[model samples]
Target: MTKPTLYLHIGAGKSGSSSIQAALARCAVPLREQGFLVPGDKLEPDATVSGHQLWFFQGLPKDEPESQKKVLRRLLRCKNAMAEQECHSLVVSAENLINRRKFPDLFLDVDKHFRVVVIAYLRRQDQYIQAHWQQWGFKSHPDFDDWIANGLGDIANWDVALADWEAAAFKKQIIVRTFERPKLHGNDVVLDFFNILGLDGKTFDLGNTEQNRGFSELTLRIAERNRDLFDGPHDNRFFAFLGEHLGSVVYEKEGGSIHLGKEDRQRLLDRFRAGNERLRKTYFPDQETLFDESNLPDRLELSEAEWSQREHDLIWRLLFAMHRRK
Candidate 1:
């Protein structure tokens, strides 16, 4: 019997991972009928949010030996079940898996059972850093300079992050997709992913599920100022509430915002230029460039007075909105 193929969507986050996961969860049954198994539907039936997060969690270094064994057993059981059902492919997606430097070690025992294909979406470093900072760094570091200076920029280095997988024993193929809209098939990550799976995306329900929108500039500045108050596990709740209430207000007023200036964007792109070029040549030789740079934002320089006025107005509006909500 031919071994079932296992596709791992190891993410470079700030890409549209959440939406893809949600889509997979939503279409689990239909996909199974088509001989593709989303393991979370079987392994984690009661999970509120889907995707094989438990698989990744159990594979972590901190997990107990017994717990790891349990997950592995469950995975084997899933494979057996898939075989019985004649499912030829299993897709496990988790954005955090990109950070696992020793990625092959996690699947060493199971590589023989499946042809493992690793898939990742690479976003431009400048946009990735800005989105990542807004999503996570603003809570702790607040200042973009401080956050980037702390070596967080290294996360965007796809060549380094994927080196272990490139040379792993489980290497069936590595599919690297550009995260830029123009580059993606159908200008959508979900559609691009379905295309990768050899499925017509229009066949699926493809609900209007948008996930993880970044905070606006005004909200980010306020969150930065109040970073000290967000020093707990529930900080995400606070950020979500602020974003839910105030994210649109700034957008309505300012049209759109650009977090990185032209020079900063250029500097970041330059820092990763060599690695990115190597990646482009290795994975996508047909493409002229790894990422399109034609539409990059021009320089943005805000005067102190302008910043203060924007902040003051945003705060007053926030206060009024809160009162109205009550």
Candidate 2:
């Protein structure tokens, strides 16, 4: 039988992307038996984020297609692996990939020879904007406002970035998820997601958040201090030399209280409401009202001293693990 194929997921970043990626990586063996082919045992490089490898600057000249083509060349190599393996379906799960203006153009290239579908998750805009800001802040961003003015600050209109997925005519080809529901735990979400790809889950590991879940204020500050540190490949070495120091620098306690404020938050929330309405009109109903903010963990609870101890302990443990691996 000719191996049928589908690109099962086109992600919305920070919406449990790490967990989903972790689940697929852990269950590679079982997933293969079911005819799905995920990438091999390696973390794929992210070209778009702070490290600057993807070269997705908004105002780059059209004559400078060379920059984007470099990224596409790498993607083609990955696509070749999927086709050669003759796996049932493939999921291209990078949130930033869909954030580009050329999403439809890019998908057309894939659908020329393969079936393609997009899977995405949504969080309320107000909450997500704040979370997204805090995430960027975790990188030790000194001038946080500048980062917001340029980068994900406009993410409330992220669908606008992708030419709005609905405008791409992916009605039957896309999956949109809201993060409000609790059952969407990393593995459980994928188990439910599998039905869309004609997949089924089996005995597998839990979510990958165990090691990197909590973000203390202290840890977030450390991350922001040397923001541009851990990034990109170094001569085919997947565990680049710089990333080796992530434990030394980052920790669950580094993140302090978020300060996006009530006024700024309200503005962002209003934008999200507009976008959410647009999304529901095109896709599902307005079932997004279910997310209640009262249940979220308090962000300002951790003191500096408490977080510093946690940071030191986690880093010490990580250094020991790395030493043992050597």
Candidate 3:
């Protein structure tokens, strides 16, 4: 019997991971028939989401060795189950796995039984930070400067993140791909991910599904003001209601555009310029730059008075929305 192969899509998040995972789940039966099993979908605690967050959580470091021992046992059982089903390929999709410093160590025992492949998708630093900033605002309002200096700012520096994953993967090749559409194999993320797995894109039924749309500027303003009142571990329902109903409202309003200033954006680009160049040369040698910025819309700067007026209007809308909900 041939040994099974395991693919790890350990992510640099906000890189269309949710969509890819959803597609994987949609095609799981067909993929299994084709000898590929996406076990992550089944392992997710919430059937609606398509990530193996529980597996990632199990492997996250804890103070006690017992937790690690239990995780290893669970992994062993999972592998045995896959083998019994005669599945020759298993995919583990978890964006959070990249944050686990002991990434390779988590699978040292499993490697002895199967082939391990590590794959990652990366976006340009400029685009990555912009998208991440929007996502972060959904959960909490953090000052962009402080957020950059602390939370997500360092994540876009691909050189550092990739290097860390490479070191953890031991002898395995870390297959890296750019998230830019033109650079992607099929110019579609789900198709691109499947292409890497040696599957024909035509075989899968990918639906028109959108996941985790970020908060708009007006929504962000409301979230910033009310975070202390309603933000907590169990408030995703409230956030979802705001995003689904009000995200578009913000876009239609005049002067509602909220984004980093040109100076700040340029500073972020400059900070990552040298690192991005290195990454392109190392992974994507065909590209001149990690990102093509010639087509980006010019930033629209709002004066203090304009911003204040916008905020006052947005607050009214927020309060009205809340009152209606009640």
Give the candidate number with the greatest lDDT.
1
Give the candidate order by descending lDDT.
1, 3, 2
Worst 10 residues of 1 by lDDT: 40-49
TM-scores of all candidate predictions against the true structure: 0.86, 0.65, 0.80
lDDT digits (tens) for residues 1-326 of candidate 3? 56677787877677878878778778877777887766553342213435445344644557435545654665556567676777777777887666555655566566666677888888766667776765653355457667677666356777776677666554346788877888777787778888888987767777753455544555555566566755552366656665555566654433313566556666777888888887778777997887775655446566878868877876687788877777
lDDT of 1: 0.74
Error of 2 at 284 (Å): 3.0
* lDDT comparison, 2 vs 3, better candidate: 3
Clashes of each: 0, 17, 0
lDDT of 2 by residue, 100-159 (tens): 666454444445446667777766665665566545433444565675656554564645
Give candidate 3's TM-score.
0.80
Estimate every model's Cα lDDT from 0 to 1: 0.74, 0.52, 0.66
Q: State the lDDT of candidate 1 residue by residue for 202-320, as single tens digits.
A: 89997965666665666666676777767652367766666667666644423234457777788888888998888889888997778887777764557879978988887788888
Give the 10-residue window scoring lowest on summed lDDT in candidate 3: 40-49
